[model samples]
Target chain A: MRVRTESILPYSLLAPTLIFITLLIVVPIFQAFLLAFQTADGEFTLTQFEKMIADTSFADALKFTFLLLIFIVPAQVVLALVMALLIHTRFKGHTFFLYIYALPLAISDLAAGIVWLAIFTERGFLNSGLFQLGLLERPFLFLSYQNLPALFSTLIIAESWRATAIVMVILLAGLQVIPRDYFEAADVFGANTLKRTLFVVLPLLRPSLQNALIIRTIFAFQTFAVVLALAGRVIPVLTGEAYNWYALNRNANIAAAYSTLVLIFTVIATVVYFRLLRTSTAEAGFD
Target chain B: MAGIQFQSIRKIFGKTLAANDVSLEIKDGEFMVLLGPSGCGKTTLLRCLAGLERVDGGRVLIGARDVTELAPRDRKIAMVFQSYAVFPHLTVFDNIAFGLQMQSRPRDEIKRRVEDGARLLELSDYLARYPAQLSGGQRQRVAVARAIVMQAAVLLMDEPLSNLDALLRLQMRAELKRLHQEIKATTIYVTHDQVEALSLGDRIAVMQNGRIVQCDAPMNIYDYPANKFVGGFIGTPPMNFLPGVVRVNEGKPIAAVGESHIAPSVALASALIEKNGQPILLGIRPENLALASAQHANTIRARVLVVEPLGSHKLLTVQVGAEISKVSVAPDQRVAPNDDVWLHFDPEKIRWMDAATGDAIHPG
Candidate 1:
């Protein structure tokens, strides 16, 4: 059999990335598995798993993580799609709106959490504004443990505001790649704007939507700083619990166990999104 | 089918006059071709009629209604784009049925119309196939089928065959002409290819710089163009031009070329009589120039420069003073390069145009 240099050259070029991934990702995942299952004396043990299951906040963390995704993903998807469509309209000042819509993508998740922390503080803008407008008689305690709904609502809003921009940018790229003739053809065919968006834009935007959903869901499961900054342990999410176990309790084994749980949950959510949004190859004209 | 009337239609794009005071009336069921080179606003005028482009001035009437401000959907027109903008995601049947569905037609009616269109365009077998699975010719047929299935008041084709290969273009051109005859819909076709324009258009509207220079029957435009640009633009190998001054000899108008003088044809001579001492452009087609056996009244003595042998006929390039004129000779007629020949211009075939304005000096 003859070997070609062209075929082997690509693999050689990919060698550095393969090595880095093996060292940084593959080795760490293996070490995490070992740490979760074994004791410091190197004996196989179920001690960390028992502790993880018995932790008082474990069920709350898992449930709240899923709840956050349920709240944030749909809201962000709707907001991003609307923003993308507005930009696609190319009205006057659309460029200005495009820059403003994508501005939140530049802010880090920690910074975004801190930014919203200022808004939801007891004497922050919301409470002061409500009091000045006579909507309230006094400043409200928004992030208190007793105000769980307000705390959760504020977290959802902050996450949606900070993260929807990435999805909007993705959808905007997808919208721009669609040839203008399709829309013109639809118009000449007597399709109203709503029908055009439903039958033309959304179906064509399926791949981008799938990608955005999967990424957002995975990140939603790992949400930490925003919940921490706003609620201060009042809200328990998966990554927050993992941070508490490692940073506060100083237990590496339990932290690794929590991390594994987050990973598993992310993978499951990603799979569910794939199954729900999958475009059949035949329908996409691949066949 | 409905007729189209554009009264002083004007369109401006930024600083460019895309369609400038253009007026045309296309009869119902007539195939009118807007013919010009690129950037001459032929497509812009077609887009205006389709209501895709908003005219800055004047009125557009389709049938009896004014449609200048109406949306493209309300204009009751279907357009086939140059790129064959058939929806890629839809099957052939669904693509053909799209316009009807938009109109909220009954399901059975839509199905019957789509099936009929598929049969007409020979696309019945490919009804279930997506556009990506079809060949270029099939995709174009699907586009045409979609347009005709709408049964629009007018059909607009913007260089629909420009994307196909040579053989496919020829085949589709004939198919389109047949389709027009079968459907009998008023179609405004736009093309830059003179052959397509001349072959397909019942009336060819030649445009230049956003203005319709001449609109007339294809044969009339071919035989007697209204201006020098039309004359040079219409025919294959183009009409040959010779610069000459009009002079009187024995009370007759003679086109004087340096040391040689040929009397203008009677019809042309009358138009040139009053314009004596002014330069005129003498226009003749290549086929109109014949080999003169001996010295004749309207013959110019010249030397053959190059011989281009086509399959059926040979083209002889002859030098008449400083200008070179092509004369088509029969294949059997032996001719070689650099041979002295006396070429006679058919009297009735000569065209006299004003040199400055380029307009034909037609005899009253």
Candidate 2:
């Protein structure tokens, strides 16, 4: 009886958290999967998936989302690397600069979109200042362009500014774990800055880089609020279009199909990333 | 290969002096150990010699070159850190080959030298393994192999054997000595262990508070210590110091402790007479003091406090007047607590120090 009581106590302690996760995460996921193959009257069918793939707006949104990813992921990673290096160098007022760089991390995606809107909108600060300097005859329309390149570049800027801090934090933690003796050893060996960074620093930081890449890509795939705030009715991302299908069009089946597609893409990306990283950093002893 | 000379080198960090006006000369092909307690600037001095740390005011000469302003690699020196500092990601083979590769040696020559170093250090079997996979001793040996392949004019080692177990430390120490003999490289070793310093160094520099108190052959440093600090630091069980005053008795000087007077040898008596009844501290080693039964001369009575038998020898702690003293005797000699015993010392082994200054009163 005592042993049974002890065993029961552990499960009882874990019951609340397990139940909460089932209600909040597991149930929703199961419901979405079920809803994806059902019609409006709840009859099982493949029509919703077929319709989702054939929709022209769905194709355009997928292309724009992939385009945003191509530009934003690289920009954020490079900017984060530079910011992390600057902080590691310990310049004067370094803490102040860290807080400034990390400020966007706390801002919501919707708030970030609004902030960028204040800069790139007509008669915004950037164009108004340019006009005051007599460099522009009128306020430039920076975000209203129909060209895909202009739209892609603006998305890259907003995402890079909003999300680079997460990568910086991971890289900073990696830099801190490296013993100073290795750097001193390199200096004694006459390895210059470039050699030290390439041979010592980069190899030691591989695990952190892998983690940052996986997390940033997952976040990029689910990006919705910022796209809605910036592009509104003019542009569509996967999440934004899913929201429109479920809430505006009242088509829960097609929305579930879009969610299933996003999940498939995210899983594939994560698996590919993990497999490549495992091969490249097998000897780093980072398990 | 050339000798290294530091002429009045000083290094100050903020308000604290890490090394102050330290002048030393390490002869070519000699293994010199800087021995001291922690924070004694031995490692700092070794780093300065390696050009890892710059001196505030002084000249550092390697052979005849003034290398004070030169970088570490340009100084043609290699260092083995206490942690071994093996590149974790690189295999042992690559670690040893790094220096040769940096010099842009031909691929064949680089392979040959790395293999030679691996053979010497007995690391050929482990060449394919990374540093994380090796044991502490194996990793340390890899660090040595890496330094040897460089063929630098000087090699600096900072307490390289300190992180190993007792058995491994002893084994590695002998291996290092053997390697140094074969290579005959000008080596500077830093350690806080007196046994390691005495066993490994051709000449040992004893440092205290960032200053070298004595630099000489190990035997001289042990036998003729320059001050109370050196006498206390260099020996196992350490040299025992007793506070006393020197006085003239029938034209012979004697050290008066509490109510007892210990007769001094002629050399010590004459040195004390020159000071004219000044207060002095007397130093005597535990091995120098014997049981009264086995004594030839200079015996004093005391009460035994404890007896520790250490197989070959017995150490007896005895109360002599107001101070306690340790005397070494043969293991067969037995004594109990509260037993009366007599302690004896050779008069010639008695050392005198100034009571106030702690400096040894050397014989003129």
Question: What i-RMS does each candidate reach, in Å?
Answer: 1.6, 2.7
* Residue lDDT tens for model 2, B1-364: 8899989989988887889999999899999999999998999899888888889989999989999998876888888999988988888998888767666789999999999999999999988887777889999999999998888889999999999999999999999999999999999999999999999999999999889999999988887788999999998878888888888877877877765677876666677887766888888888888777543446767889999998989888888887888888888886787988667767778777898988988766
Model 1 per-residue lDDT tens digits across residues A204-247: 78889989888888889889888888887878887998899899
User: Where does candidate 1 chain B have its weakest 10-residue lDDT segment?
Assistant: B258-267
> Highest lDDT among the candidates is held by which one?
1
lDDT of 1 by residue, B1-364 (tens): 7999999999999999989999999999999999998999999999889888889999999999999999998999998988877887678898999899988899999999999999999999999998888889999999999999999989999999999999999998999999999999999999999999999999999999999999999989988998999999988889988888999877789888666677766766677888889998889999998997677778888899999899899989889888988899898888889888888888788888888889988885
Every candidate's CA RMSD: 2.9, 3.1
The lDDT per prediction is: 0.89, 0.85
Worst 10 residues of 2 chain A by lDDT: A278-287
- Listed for each candidate, the true contacts retained, as a fraction, are 0.40, 0.41
True-structure lDDT of candidate 1: 0.89
Q: Is the docking of candidate 2 incorrect, acceptable, medium or high quality?
A: acceptable
DockQ of candidate 1 relative to the true structure: 0.52
